[model samples]
Target: MLIRLAIRDVVLIEALDLDFSAGLGALTGETGAGKSILLDSLGLALGARADSGLVRHGADRAVVTASFDVSEDSVVTGLLADNGLEGEPGEPLIVRRIVKADGGSRASINDQPVSAALLRELGTRLVEIHGQHDDRGLLNARGHRALLDAFGRFDTGPIATTHARWRAAEAALEAARADIETAERDREWLDHAVAELRQLAPEAGEEETLAADRAAMQKGARLAEDLGHVTTHLDGSDGALAGLRQAARRLDRIAHEHEALATALAALDRAVIEASEAEDALAEAGRAMAFEPERLDAIETRLFDLRGIARKHRVQPDQLAALAEELEARLSRIEAGGAGLAALERAVAAARTDYEREAAALSDARAGAALRLDKAVAGELAPLKLDAARFRTAIERLPEAQWGADGRDRVEFLISTNPGAPFAPLVKIASGGELSRFILALKVALAEAAGARTMIFDEIDRGVGGAVASAIGDRLARLSTKAQLLVVTHSPQVAARADRQLLIAKSHDGTVTRTGVRLLDEGERREEIARMLSGAEVTDEARAQAGKLLAA
Candidate 1:
């Protein structure tokens, strides 16, 4: 509920701070007394488009701030939370807007800067301004479906979930079909590539192993002739082993002749044994290093093939094995494509069926709701002096292109002012006064389902008086029991029906004209209502009538 509205330098309202209480509050004064200015200021705070003309002369800018006390579960609270603008849980929600003289505006919620569009969206949830010219709230045909659902207390979650599932299934099917078509286009290439990779059979480490062997073979070939010469010197009959053994035998024969000779003979025998072992080691090394010329050529050919295949596939030689597997999988998918596509098609169809079933059921439920709503609104029409008028909750089946999560129906409130006339849109069929009354009846019928916490009616009691004005007053009072109501009016019956009355009046100081609002006391309210009942003055009879209305 709106608790306060603070406006500064807005037109004639140089500075105004008005405290609002619960229940029906009436703003009453003579014509041109600035009631519209007050509502315009509130609208500015609620994110209405800024106008440079609204700024007071010589003022740089105009500012309006609306403070509302919102419940934790209120839509306004949820909107604030969604925007990352948090405040103390029970504190008032402050929406402030400043309109510069240049027509640019800035908006903030709970002191956090936000876009004007966001503020407007939250405004729709926080307060609904209903008048003959209102294009938001109940009169916006776009929101009619939601209003009807709210009225019927319908839970659309199931249909919404089903719709999502159906769409997802359809998307999945589309993606799969697209993928299969692309894969089919590459079918021949995939088959050839898989065959080639399988034939090459490149192993992860095979390239490294082959390269290492090729290097070793090339090095051994460079050393082959030198190694052969060395082996000949170490192991042939005329080489070092033979020569050492011959010397040892000669020394053994003269060993007993002298001690020196004997020591020399022992050394010669040890040299012969060491030379024999060296020759054996050389023979073994030659055999180990040997590589056939044909073997080297074969290894080089294999390495070249592996590298060429890797380049062709845009992969390292090590990835060739994995690439082959991937190609095979694609081939397998192509071979089994029909079954997979069929299964997806079945899923899409089933999901669509589920969604359509739920949507149809919801449409039926809405038709029933529309009937009940029309009956309820019919009950309120006559009391507001609209007995000759007819109200209807028109539900039209929308085309498939317009079908959505909310279901496949377009809902709107239509009215006919005369018994034989065709029903037309509420706004188009009624005059300004009739339109306001129609909105009021619709609002009263919607009751707690009307969405906004606060509702402002601009001159709803216009062009009506006597019991008609009293009945309108009683209904406004009745509507206020469920939500805060602020009505701008000239009817004394309506003003007298308010739990609180504010008097808006303009005064001139010769050089400047200013508008101000004052909360009325009991005597003040009586006199204001008297002035409303009479013309230009408050007569004794009018005061008495005002007193009786208040007492009633």
Candidate 2:
């Protein structure tokens, strides 16, 4: 429930701090008594859009702050936690909004800065403002389904779970269809590529190995002619090694005839040995240089084919093997397309059946809920002076193809204000006075189910009089049994119903005008109620009526 409201420099309200209480409280004053200004300030603190003109004439900015005391598990607390604001269980949440004269605004919750949009989102969960022109409470189409469920005390868990199942099935079906379409589109290319790769029989690292062998063979071929010429010269019949051996044999035959000749024969034998070693080395070189052109040609051909295949596939040679394997798998799936598609279709059909069954159940539940809600709201209308008004929970079927997260039903609150009057939307058919009463009836019906600790009614008595005003006040007081209510009103009867009474008055000083609110005592409340009933005069009869009202 809203615990406090503080306002500064907002239009006629220069500075004001008002503490609120649980149960039905009323704010009453004459016209132009700054009652509207007070509510407007509360609205600002609740994240309503700010206007530069709202700032006081001499002030640079305007500020509004509201404090709410909510339970630990309240939706407002969850919202604050979601936005990283601070709040403890059963603690008061302070939401402050500041609007500068330059058309800029700031918002915060529990002293932590937050965006105005976030603050507004949190505010909606905490407080609902119902007025003549206010389409928020039960009149909003967005909340009609929720209101219906609440009124009927229907459990929505099953419906939500069913909706989730339906969406999941839909998502899976879509994904499968996309996959099938893409595979079908690429079927021809995949088949051809797979066949080509199978024919090529590419292997990882084959290109590098083959290229290295081809290069070695080509180098050998380039040096083959030079090696052959050197071999011929080294092994010819009159080559140095053969000639040296012949000379060594002749020197050995004459070595005993002369010592010097024997020494020369020894040196010639060493030279022949060195020449023979040289000849052996040349023969080994000749064998190594004998290049096999056929082997070289084979290596070149393999290398060219590998490189060509890599280029055709737009991949490096090393990636060709992996790419081919992937293509083969894709082609295999395409070849078995009939079987694959049939299996997917069966899965999709089964999922759809499950989803449809759940959705149908949810639809039935909602229909039942709507019936009960219609009766409940109708029962609440007579006392609120809406005897001729009709309340409806209208549900229409959405196309199965257009089903969404909320399922296939569009729910709206439809109403007919008079007999034989065609039922139109509640917001369109109900007059300002009628809308306020309708909202009150619905709130009284669903207050317990909504679990809202507080319900604030801003001038809900607008355009009402006499018994109708008393009826409104009586219902408000009754509503306080379940939850707190704060009403800003001009009706003396409405003021008379409060467990507490507050008066908002504007007073001007020599330099500035200020707005302030005071909680009235029993005597003061009587005078205030008299002021509301008799306008400028406080008559004895009005006070007598006020006394009777208080006694009642």
- Candidate number with greatest TM-score: 1
RMSD of each: 4.5, 6.5
Tens digits of per-residue lDDT for model 2 on 142-259?
7777666666666666656665765665576567567667988988887788888888898999988888777766777898888777666656786666677788888889899999
Q: Relative to the true structure, how large is the alpha-carbon lDDT of every model?
A: 0.89, 0.80
Angstrom error of the Cα, residue 57, model 1: value is 0.9
The lowest-lDDT stretch of 10 consecutive residues in candidate 2 is 282-291
Model 1: clashing residue pairs? none
**What digit string (tens of lDDT, one per residue) describes model 1 on residues 163-202?**
8888899899899889889999999999899989889988
Sum up the clashes in candidate 1.
0
TM-score to native of every candidate shown: 0.87, 0.79
Error of 2 at 376 (Å): 1.7
Error of 2 at 325 (Å): 2.1
